[model samples]
Target: MTEQHGSDTGPRYAARRRRGGIVSFVVGLVATLAFFAFFPGMPHVIDWGAVLASLAVGALARAGCRAWMAKEAEKEGKRIGHF
Candidate 1:
C-alpha cells in the first residue's frame, strides 16, 4: 500500500469548514441576543431579522474558510479535491 506524504485529506478540510460555519453562526446569534438583552424589555420581543443575519454570517464564514484553506493548500502544492 502507498500513502501520500505531507498531504491533507478532503474530508478533514470539509469538516473544518463546516465547523467554522457552525461556530460563527452560534457566536453571531449569541452576540445578537446579548445586544438585545443589554436593554430592558428587549428579550420580550424576538427579532427574526437578527436570526436571519446570523445565518448569513455563518454562510460567509464557511465560504471564507473554504477559500482560505484551498488557497493555503495550493500554496503548499497540495491538491485537495472535492469531497
Candidate 2:
C-alpha cells in the first residue's frame, strides 16, 4: 500500500522567509546608515573596523528578525500561496 502525503509547504515558506528577510535587511541597513550619519559623536566613538563590525551585526540581526517573523507567519498559516 502507498501512503499519501499532504502538500509540501517548504518552498512556499522559504520564499516568504526570503522576501521578509530582504525587506528587513533594507530597512535595518537604512536606519543604521541614517543613525551613523546623523549622530555627530558616533564617528569619534567608533573606528572603521568597529563600524564594519557593527554593520555586520546589524545585518545578522535583520536576518534573525526576518526568520522570527517568518516562523511566526508559518505558525499562523500565512504561507505565500495561501493568501
Give the number of the best model, judged by TM-score.
Answer: 1
Which residue pairs in candidate 1 collide? none
Instruction: Write down the lDDT that model 1 would get.
Output: 0.65
Each prediction's whole-model lDDT (CA): 0.65, 0.62
Tell me the spans in candidate 1 whose CA falls farther than 4 Å from its real position: 1-5, 10-45
User: Which 10-residue window in model 2 sums to the lowest lDDT?
Assistant: 1-10
On lDDT, the leading prediction is 1
What's the C-alpha lDDT at position 37 in model 2? 64
Per-residue alpha-carbon lDDT of model 1 for 1-83, expressed as tens digits? Answer: 54443635556656776676667667766766566557676665548876676566656665666677778877887657662
Candidate 2 lDDT? 0.62
lDDT of candidate 2 at residue 50, scale 0 to 100: 56
Once fitted onto the true fold, the runs of candidate 2 whose alpha carbons sit more than 4 angstroms away are: 1-8, 40-54, 77-83
Q: What is the total number of backbone clashes in candidate 2?
A: 0
lDDT of each residue in 1-83, candidate 2, tens digit only: 53223243457555656777677776766666666667876664545665675577668867687767756766766543322
